[model samples]
Target chain A: MASGEAILAHGSAAKRPGSPWLSGFVAATISEIKSLYREPAALAFTLGQPIVLLVILVAFDFHTTLPNGKVVPYLDVLVPGLIAFIGMTVGLNGVLFPLSRYKERGILRRVAATPMPTGSFVVAMIVSRLLIALAVTLITWIFGVYVFGADLTGSAVLLIAFATIGSLAFIALGILMVAFARSEDDVAPLMMLVLIPSILFSGAADRQPRPRPHRPRHRYPRPRHLVRRRDHPGRLALQDGVARYE
Target chain B: MATIPAPTRESASHTAQPPALRVANLVKHYKKFEAVRGISFDVQPGEIFGLLGPNGAGKTSTLEIVTGLRDATSGSVEIFGIDIAHHRAEARALLGVQLQESDFFDHLTLKEQLEFLGACYGVKPDTEALLGYVDLADRPNWRLKQLSGGQQQRFALAAALVNDPPLVLLDEPSTGLDPTARRQLWSLIRRLQAGGRTIVLSTHYMEEAEELCDRVAVMDRGVIAGIDTPLALIQQLIDTGFKREVVVRDATLEDVFLHLTGNTLDGVSLDDARKED
Candidate 1:
């Protein structure tokens, strides 16, 4: 396809004002996941990165207290943050990166031609990510609370809200990536570059550093996975990665 | 003017329900530029209407509107008396569309894709039967990426027929196929037309429009420059009747190559590459 025609489609799809929120969101998310899961390399990157981070933080973790006042399993606190973290990862890394490639490969153009409402397309995407995020949330909580002692002061409503907003933030980031990406080949590296910094900055796996509380508290939500270890020899880099649950 | 014969109108209703399709003063504007500017036409039941145009000539934009995929900036589209502007879903329920560059999951088998589409169309016919119709029943295990371009196109065509809707819109069905593959596809399309289905197609290739379309709408710059049967369209351009000549080269390469290799579409064994390699 010519570049101008493809650009026209991208504009319309992104600009559909009446796009249905849930179904369109779900369909778009589903298609993104569908394409992502189809690629073994991408799957390894998206799912593997989070699990590997969790394991590294646990080995070097300094945080023993859960978010609640009561003494609780570190795993309990770690699990919920992981939900928000994985969501962030999937949004920026999983959905956005591939969407750039999709634009280059003309997937969006092909879909734009169909009578399928653009609203439906967007809804599908959001739904797919939410579903995957939900599943990951349930599994991690069940395993963490039952297998290890942990506490969650979070209400079901609060948890759901967190995932939705977190998802939107990630989706916005993903669209921005698509807008700026120059070619299909650049998508993978750019996604990794953007995602690594965001995850690291959010303290998804903080370990050794004793976080000096922000002078003016960070208005942005950050997941604190680890903090300074009292008597551990594990490297500070690893400890800072585990500071979120301290 | 001679009126068309009113031999019969058979369906759930016979209340002179408008022609299967009608368009009047259809216009679409992209800001100040008009992609489709007030073109009008009608398609009777069971007619193969071809909209011929070059790329960027608004052929696709018009078809999209007719299929209720996109709303026209101005004018009307009627499908069996249903207004497309007000009843998109109802208008669209009667059409099936095959776009030029469709893609599905690479992991999905041919059977899985057909079954999924069938469920969406709400016509759950036997999966094997549908596969057989597309001539891919034996390759059900093969992934979508594994199939040749011809196989993929045929799979798409079969998927379009899953609902067996009355109207099928094929945008450049033979765009990238080999000659034999193209011929086979045209034959399959003929079979569908013979079964009393209405088909509308867009093509840049003049020969394809000439060979397949029962009637042609020659469009240029988003307007119908002419409309008639292919022969009529071609003939309308001539003031005096003329005859054409044919020549056979001593040994055309295509014949020699085919004679040596063989000419068959299902003969993929001749071109199959090992998956590991």
Candidate 2:
């Protein structure tokens, strides 16, 4: 809390369009953080959901034994899946719930009346939630590595790239969801409806039901060099390229 | 790109400043409905202007357009000589707005709410004095959800005044208040006016208009039915030979109710308390 004179001084300073935009951005971010920290339920739900899921995943211990007498830890396999799951859940729920609730409660309308741009306000909120998601993911990844001895087989850069893409995708989906939703009440059901299928069916799901392996035909024998996915155009193109090479 | 508002001739001169707020030929069309149609008005620098209307008269729509919250079909709004369409942030800096609803983050405490909103305006407010000014100093740590209706509205008022802007826009500031609370709000509004702050508010209460507004714009069906000082409007009606067959008594039912109810301004009133439930 500052003095009245300080506030007046700041107000006069802010009146100029020439004033640094960063101050307003910083203020909006701080406001977003304050509101976020104040809501105990929201804080619990966001942080708790991932931890609860991790607990369930660890308890399941769904493992796979490799061909070379090596046993692959289930947590290692599940970690990537969990990352995607966490990314999607955080990206969708983190942004949509508050955004829709704010719109429904006229908070957005009220902020729209202020000097702060709604774009910047919304961006601040999303960025804060994204940071929270980053923290949650880091914690989960640490637990996977230390507690479960999960092997990090792939490039960390690749994992990060995929996570970032997944996050962006889910956030875009969340914004689309909010656009269709009339109010906060509309958000919950829509999220549940969308997320349940995604969690159950997406490749992020634990132990996806492997499809039947396709057998090559004798007439136009599938190229051994190309991975088998007869329905995919990429596989077809690869087969054509292999034939041309042959 | 062509939508940018070209600098108007009026703002070119330094001595002749633009009005505090100006809306010209404003129209808002939502699908088949025209919420505000060709409406226009100018608010002076230090006047308490009232928009008196019933529900669905487009007062909020007009206010929204002026605030740059919603796009108009075709119109222009200038605040402190800056066209809102071109320079929304610059113009918004000159305005303080208390929306029609007491919409705030439910989790944040009163002090936090003030600080958060103040930060949004890039202002560092004296939250203690601000809360004290709005008579909520004692309950600085109280969350928005914990506040009674009247208390919340008052807190919202404090939030609105956090930046100390020259013009304040209040949309139905006294809508849900008890009679006592409404009076308290009226006094607060008067205090602002005395401090030379320009205020434009919308309310349905005729008494509120007569008591607080320097000029009233009576709106009906998305257009201005009439605009004048409350007294002048009444005087015009009187001069036009409009009369009631039955003379009204000095004390109305509301006055009797207030007399019986003892004009409770405190947040402990049953209606105010019921908000939590």
- Per-residue CA lDDT of model 2 for B1-277, tens digit only, reads 0121222222222336667788888889999998888877877777788899999999999888878888889989998889988998888877889988638877677887776777777676678766765677788898887877877787777787877788889999998887767776776677666666778999999999998887788888888888877887898899999996897699988777767774355633434422312
Alpha-carbon error at A138 in model 1, in Å? 4.3
Q: Model 2 Cα displacement at B178 (Å)? A: 0.9
Q: How many Å off is the CA of A140 in candidate 1?
A: 4.6
Q: What DockQ results for candidate 2?
A: 0.21
- Candidate that scores best on TM-score: 2
lDDT of 2 by residue, A36-82 (tens): 56678877876677657656655543344334433343455677777
Which residue pairs collide, candidate 2?
A: none
lDDT of 1 at A69: 27
Q: Against the correct fold, how does model 1 do in TM-score?
A: 0.71
